[model samples]
Target: MTLKVERLGHSTRLQEVSFAAQPGELVGILGANGAGKSTLLQLLCGVLEPDAGQLTYQQRDLTQISAYERRQLLGYLPQTPVAEGGIRVDHFLQAGLVNLHLSCPGKELNRVVETLQIHALLERTLDKLSGGEQRRVHIARALLGDHNWLLCDEPTTSLDLYYQLQVMAVLRAQADRGKLVTLALHDLGLAARYCDRLVLIDKGRLLAEGAPAAVLTDANLAQAYKIKARWLCTDEGVTLLPSLLS
Candidate 1:
């Protein structure tokens, strides 16, 4: 089944943005700050309603689904860490599965903890961890469920380069395993390297949508980010290295 947004719009933010993504694809949403990336994610997850268009999954109207069903379909990770209390990480992760009423909560916890490499942080209190560590914990919790779509907003924000790559890899692996993974990223290099497809939104409109190589062009970079960027081709994929605006 494919998830699609048709003519998605919000009066002040987005304007007739349209796109579609299917399972097993890592889709990246890229744009300048306040370019409606977060708003787009929120609309997809039903956190905000589009005043002008529709969100559909496999031809079913998403706006008509119940809250519980919507929860089962989408897992969202906000840009800021939402769990800041002093709860133990293990308990926190377990609560995520429990809230979903999973039949095998323990199994889910083990899967996420191992996949995210957060075994060491499992026993620590949430508030005691650094910002990056907390981000890892949140990511693990978000991954605890078997949701079809994972919408992440800047999941790599506070991480060092190592952890940033680590998190991105886990997300990519999720896409490989037949889940639709979409994330908002500021790192053009990472977005181009890890994402299978890119949705470049410039000033609240979709400027381009296609493979990373097709979307991250020099003109797109200058128009969206106001910078002259060079695309470096590598064996892995293309990477955008931005230089000063001409």
Candidate 2:
């Protein structure tokens, strides 16, 4: 799956932004608040149509696809998961898989639960779970259904260090399995360590896109977040360290 955005817009925040992500790749959208990160994810998920641009899947016009069909292929985790009804974890996940209409009554649910490390909370009510647990459960629900593309916005927004790392690991594993994972992350270090590629956005425009070492440079980081940072490359991969701003 490749996403192409040409002259896309919404109100005054997001302007004509364009970019693409190949299959099995993890692309992180990096920027500060109000930089249109969330808006861009919404556009990719087809929740909001581009005011003036093209959004296609496999070289075919996506606009022609119905909403139901789009839901079948796209899995979205918004900044805040919808906390509706006193639904139980197992039931919520079951609801999410209704669209696929496939046969995953037991194995798939257990896989996601184990993958996200939420097996203990399976029987608990959603409203009773902790924030981090809820995040993991929401992700499980999104992954329960059959979807090829994942659009996650600030997935680890409100979680402790442990849960944050766990979420990142889950996404990384999905990417390794040849699935497209696009995420918006504020933690530059987390993005650098986990994502395969980076898409830097500033005020609704794409500033840079490439490997972490290439895009998370001091100059680009400063321009995007108004901060100074150094990129250190080791055999492991690129690491970002914040430098004195003044």
Candidate 3:
């Protein structure tokens, strides 16, 4: 399956952005603050309607799908996920499946909870957890339904270095399993290392889209982020070293 956006715009927040992501492709949406990355994700997940343009899933207009059905097909993790204070982590995770009308299989929940290393925190209330821990709980919830498309906004935010890598690895595994995973990321190095493709946005416009090397050019970085940076490729992966403001 492929998700295609055609000239999608949301007021002045976003403008004429277009792209297509196929199953098994990990597409990273890269942009500076206020560059409309969040707006684009919202449009893709049906949270916000576009002022102009259309979105299609496998050649059918996305609007043709009912919102309830759309929810079944897409899994969204917003930047600030809502975690009700009084609920325990496991209860919260199970509730997500209930809302989707999916069976809350014990094995499925255990798999995600273990993958996210939240097994111990399962019995703890969300209010008792740290920001990073709470984030992981929400992530496990997002992964519960095994939806076709996973749209995440800063999935690694508040995570330590180890957890950051773990979250990226989990997302990578999802894409490898033929799920379309699109993430809004600030870390260029992580984007270069893990993403199959990159989409660069600047001032509500699409500046570039291609492989990491092509989209993360010195010229494009200067134009979009107004910075001078150096790129290094190692046996492990690519590393971006920003020197100074342009």
Q: Each candidate's TM vs. the true structure?
A: 0.95, 0.92, 0.96
User: Per-residue alpha-carbon lDDT of model 2 for 28-68, expressed as tens digits?
Assistant: 99898999999888877877777777877667677677888
lDDT leaderboard ranking: 3, 1, 2
Residue 166 alpha-carbon offset, candidate 1, angstroms = 1.2
lDDT (0 to 1) per candidate: 0.87, 0.82, 0.89
Clash counts for the predictions, in order:
0, 0, 0
- For candidate 3, write residues 1-246 as lDDT tens digits: 778888989995899999888999999999999999999988888888889999998888876787888778889999987659789888888787765755557877888888888889989999999988888888888888788889999999999889999999999999999999999999999999999999999999999998998999888998888888887888988778987673
On TM-score, the leading prediction is 3
lDDT of 1 by residue, 17-47 (tens): 8888899999999999999999998888787
Deviation (Å) of 199 in candidate 2: 1.0
Off by over 4 Å in 3: 101-104
**Which stretches of candidate 1 lie above 4 Å from their native place?**
none
Q: Rank the candidates by TM-score, best first.
A: 3, 1, 2
TM-score, structure 1 vs. true: 0.95
lDDT of 2 at 68: 86
Q: Regarding TM-score, does 2 or 3 come out ahead?
A: 3
Candidate 1, lDDT over the whole model = 0.87
Full-model lDDT, candidate 3: 0.89
lDDT score, candidate 1, position 152: 96
